[model samples]
Target: MKNAMPRTLDRLLASFLQCGTWAACALIGAGLFVGTKVLTAGVALFILLPVLRVVLMLAVFARRRDYLYVTIAATVLAVIAAGCVIGIRLGPLAG
Candidate 1:
């Protein structure tokens, strides 16, 4: 079961990325003729992919009762979340 988990997760991650890419392409391509909000939503989805991956890992590690990995993943997730919050609050910076 332990060995099977990684393999399954690997497949799942691959599928997730594939779908995300298609969604992004559709959104951006259509947005080109639509408006800025659609384009922005697509860009946000692309940017969130890595963070979503980390969150996935964190859940898996916690489920496996790997405290060390859980801690590491949680810390990383928190940092990323904080950066996202800060960026949203800061808005566009001037030169």
Candidate 2:
């Protein structure tokens, strides 16, 4: 039971990431073929993927009842969010 569940979770996570990657690529390609706003959305998805991955990690740890890891993951997520906000505030670095 224990071994089976963890393996299942791992597989689920892998499948989620794989599908997400493929979907994002398809959107980006279609955007390139089509229009401006679609291309912008595709680019936004590319930016959001890492943050989404961290959120997924936080959910996984929380599900497993691993409090310490949950805390660590949450902290990491917060830092990422903060960095994004700071970057937006600062605007372009070089030009």
Candidate 3:
């Protein structure tokens, strides 16, 4: 009974994981925003695209279990890299 579950530890782990996830997302978003072909498009894509990708990947993670955390982490990193390669441009979003 004593080892049934460690509520405090569970809470701590959850917090750490969530914080890490959010930070990863924010960094990727910022990088993507800065590096897009169009500044305005980049900003919009940075904010929205990752959110969508994360949501979709969440289900995949749930099924795979082991890959969830790693996938999320890798995704954040990919977004950052993608941002850098996107470049810059001008159009309707600039207004």
Candidate 4:
């Protein structure tokens, strides 16, 4: 049971990332022939992958009663959120 959890989590995360990457790539390719909207969607998904992964890890850690990891993941997520908020606020001026 103990060993199974980590294996399951590993498999799940790996599969999720693989599928997400493939989908994003496909969208980007299609967008090349299609339009900017599809390309933007693909780019957004690509950028969001890491955030989604962190969220997944946070959920798993909470489920496993790993408070330490949960806190760490939560902190990382908060930082990401803060950065996003700042970026949005700064807008084009940020660059």
Candidate No. with top lDDT: 4
Model 1 lDDT per residue over 1-95, tens place: 87897898798788888898889888888789999899988998898888888888888788889899899999998888898788887777621
Model 4 misplaced regions, further than 4 Å: none
Best by TM-score: 4
lDDT of each: 0.86, 0.81, 0.55, 0.95
User: Over the stretch 1-95, how does candidate 3's per-residue lDDT look in tens digits?
Assistant: 32533464356456655665566566656667665434444455446655555554555445546475657756776776676555433334456
The model with the greater lDDT, 2 or 4, is 4
lDDT of 4: 0.95
Cα lDDT for residue 46, candidate 4? 100
Evaluation by TM-score, superior candidate among 1 and 2: 2
Ranking by TM-score: 4, 2, 1, 3
Q: What stretches of model 1 exceed 4 Å from their correct place?
A: 85-94
Q: Give the lDDT of residue 55 in candidate 1.
A: 85
For model 1 the local lDDT of residue 7 reads 96
TM-score (all chains, Cα) for each model: 0.77, 0.79, 0.33, 0.86
Tens-digit lDDT track of model 2 for 27-87: 8888888987787777777778777877887898799887887899899998988987988
Model 3 residue runs over 4 Å out of place are 1-5, 35-95
For model 4, state the Cα shift of residue 31 in Å.
Answer: 0.9
Mark the 10 consecutive residues where model 3 has the least summed lDDT.
Answer: 1-10
